[model samples]
Target: MPDYYISQISHTDKTVIQGVTALLNAEGIRLDANLDYTCGMYDDEMNIIATGSCFGNTLRCLAVSSEHQGEGLMNQIISHLIEVQFERGNTHLFLYTKCSSAKFFGDLGFYEIARIDEQIVFMENRRTGFKNYLKKLEESSALQLQTLTKDTSANTATLQSDNALPDTSTADRKIAALVMNANPFTLGHQYLVEKAARENDLLHLFIVSEDASLVPFKVRKQLVMEGTAHLDNICYHDSGPYIISNATFPSYFQKDENAVIESHAMLDLTVFTEIAQTLGINRRYVGEEPTSLVTGIYNNIMSEKLPENGIECIIVPRKTDGKKAISASTVRQAIKDNDVDTLKKLVPESTLRYFESKEAKEVIERIRNSGNVIHY
Candidate 1:
């Protein structure tokens, strides 16, 4: 065994960065565009042997030279990246690796959350991370079921007075789910939720909790809750780094035009199967995507893959305001332009009033300062 050293690869240092890129390319891996830090493992001759990078809490673009296989260099690279994530206050970590490399990562204490077409495996540091997430989801489902049963009992008593015995058992309930980013909770989002809520026995609404969007997660969740307060059969859940998050779907946040949309969507829906099983979700609702190539591709993949997993993927036509389909992008553009009338037509009153209030001043400024508000 020869002595090897690991060190951070400064983004400004093109010479060392090129070496890292060449190494990753040689390993048939593209250097991810969203990395905040990259590090390389060098041999005694200062030649790059292994490399790994980090973006948020995710470890990505990892590779070990073919010639250096079984040299334990990858372990060193992973350990270094874990230390970096810990220093950045990211306790729970995640990574995406090829199916061939997943076993290696699993041996290093990572657990698989899902795999996409048997090509990419999404893994995390904690063993019970995904299990605990499923447990929490099941608990939420039980609580919602208990509430429904109680309501049904009261309704049953009323029906008994009328001499009509109706089936109020939850066994026949049609559970559905909808996943949304809802950057600012536009009317289109509300329309989708409303329709799903109307048709389903219980609708589990999972909001993307990542803060990578122009609108922060807290504000997005708050607006969604306020906008849909009229809906009674909704179990609101924060998608915590599990569903369509940076860990599961980095392309959603990075906005990489060249991203493999199908691959990302498959991984997300693969994990979504577990969530569906936990909550008895038999269907998923998504607004039809006519614009936004990335989301369009994602929806296409989802429509194809989810059905294969026993979950019906419903693509509801986008709600139109007598013109074009109302989109979050349009709402964001209206906000950027301060078009009050367009805002009134695009979002619910709660969302509109929030943007008008002082609390939304910061978020509005953030959106306005963002040069590009439309995602096409």
Candidate 2:
């Protein structure tokens, strides 16, 4: 047998795992083997010197005992875990570490994607092939340096001498704004996004990625990404539970009447104001739609409230046919009726192809037959 070997540990071995847990704790790292999908690196004596865990498909945690720090133990642990994750059909891996360790991971196969705080750095690895991974790390670091320079320049431009927003700079900032349930992205949504992108420096699309939505949040987010893959400065982010719940948008789920809708709108306005402040956004972009009373009310409230919060709201007019406005509801209706022509008109060719390939017609048929016309 090799002097150093990496293998999966069974749950029956939990008692022995306490050694690794203690080591991690001593290093100021927390590990819940029961919750986190864990792996470990043990010495010849079977004492774990290094341990790591995967949170989701994306995030991972790695900690090595300080006593064994200067050795190649950390590299072995990470390399072994990466190989295991790849074998298990994971294509991407992510981790968060102190900013001081950014160069350390970057020396490995990781590339920083974002920063959560002043201290933590979020890194990702997307390469599966060993040779490709090395090449990608080099290319990614170069690109990251360029991006960082541009980002710093942009940040400086947005800030005054005291690092506060000046009164003059507030009016020129444009934001792309939209509410996405992501039930199914239609051509109308794409049109709205294209138009919004043209007018805004940054697009902040609010995806209602909550459990209440019929389509799973991840799937919806994926659809949004697929639909808007071509746009620049367009980014996707979750609205979180607070913005999607009945407490914020009761009208979305039809839980409340006009009064609740108004209240919910007020909450959404407040939440969005805070979001804008955090993101350095000053202008909001919306799509034009006249059919839904809830949307009408939302637009009306936003028009009044956003300006008060120092955000200028701009509503983009929807693309129109000779007489009718394009909408997701119309596409859903066409899908129900098996009206291919109308569905084609309402959805982008790529989006229509995806649904058709997935046999979504059957699902739409069932929904129509059930007579449940609820929007999700």
Candidate 3:
């Protein structure tokens, strides 16, 4: 029989400490108890066959003896540790493991946050209720991955459209539509794209690249691509990490509209217009969603600035599902509640599967147990 328990290390547990030390040394993970940590293990007839530890807020050390491997013991221990961390208010959980372990935790909602010295993979899991922010991170990561593996075929489509642009000789005729932190690429975004594509022969879809959110930008961009793959006329490109996000548009988070307008709205308009001009883009497309105060400012700015810069502003109306406006928040709520029926109504089946595969149920369960009142 196997027994599992989690406990803090004390001076008396020298045998347990030595066993954990041996495992950590073998795995090349440094064990430091002074840091916030916990150890989980399975004891079978006085022998410790499996052991793992949570190192501070950043690292998860796990190892199992060869004899007891493949029994799914590691997963149970890891899940337990994660729950403990959540209870302790550790929102960001990190782990450094060999590349071989990638698929294991990836399935459990941990994603590669960074690569250390090209050897160890750093992974992290972000706590929920910051779903929008996490979605932004996923979009940015997808953009980076896409950039590293640039698809020439994807670029060819843009070039073909560029060739058809009116007065190609004029440098300002080509304009790209930018979407900074477009979390899930909602139908409103699709409406914006459609409006832009109708006006411009080539619509450059600039997905923001940043890690300010939990989903990892790469996954978010993939969702966008999958959602918009049928649109051959638009070109998908990353805005890189510097140009878009809260860092660039700090006013987006402000409670007051004027502060957001003065800071974020104006800054984004100026930045996009400058970049568009540099790239021979002469127009931009924006969706009219006044639900967000920041978005309302963006709409106002585009209406005012684009005309002055001789850039066309195309504002598409808010896409709605019956009376309610389609938003990422709504989809996230549906996911948290395990309302798959409502999710299907909100997103495409592919997107629905993406959320399902992310173990959104686990995320929702975490939310419910966190004792935080979730409005959705």
Per-model TM-score, in order, reads 0.90, 0.52, 0.51
The C-alpha local distance difference test score for the whole of candidate 2 amounts to 0.62
Give the better candidate number (1 or 2) by lDDT. 1
> Given candidate 2, what's the lDDT at residue 1?
29
Worst 10 residues of 3 by lDDT: 246-255
User: How accurate locally, in lDDT, is each candidate?
Assistant: 0.83, 0.62, 0.59
List where candidate 3 sits over 4 angstroms from the true fold: 1-174, 251-257, 358-376
10 residues in a row with least lDDT, candidate 2: 247-256
lDDT ranking, best first: 1, 2, 3
- Tens-digit lDDT track of model 2 for 1-376: 2375665655457775676668766875555422335677777888777776654443344678787887877787788777777777876766657577778888888876444334455466743332343344335434543443454456665433322222323556565566667466777778877776666655667778664443456656777778887663555666643343442221211223665456556656765665666556687877767876777787789899899988888887777655688776666677667788887777776677766776455555554675644452
Please, what are the lDDT tens digits per residue for candidate 1 over residues 248-330?
Answer: 35442222454567677777888899999887789999889777677788888888888888899999999999989998888
User: Which candidate leads in lDDT?
Assistant: 1
Which candidate do you rate higher for TM-score, 2 or 3? 2
lDDT per residue for candidate 3 within 1-376, as digits (tens), equals: 4555555555357787777767656555445433345564646455555566554454455777666677777777787778778888876766656667777878878876443232345466753323434355346534643542353344545544432333334544555565745555566566566666666655677877764443457866887788767654556766653244543332212335475355445545555655555455676776667677657776787788788987777777778888877776666566557687877877765576777685545544543454432222
Model 3: what TM-score?
Answer: 0.51
Give, for candidate 1, the lowest lDDT window spanning 10 residues.
Answer: 159-168
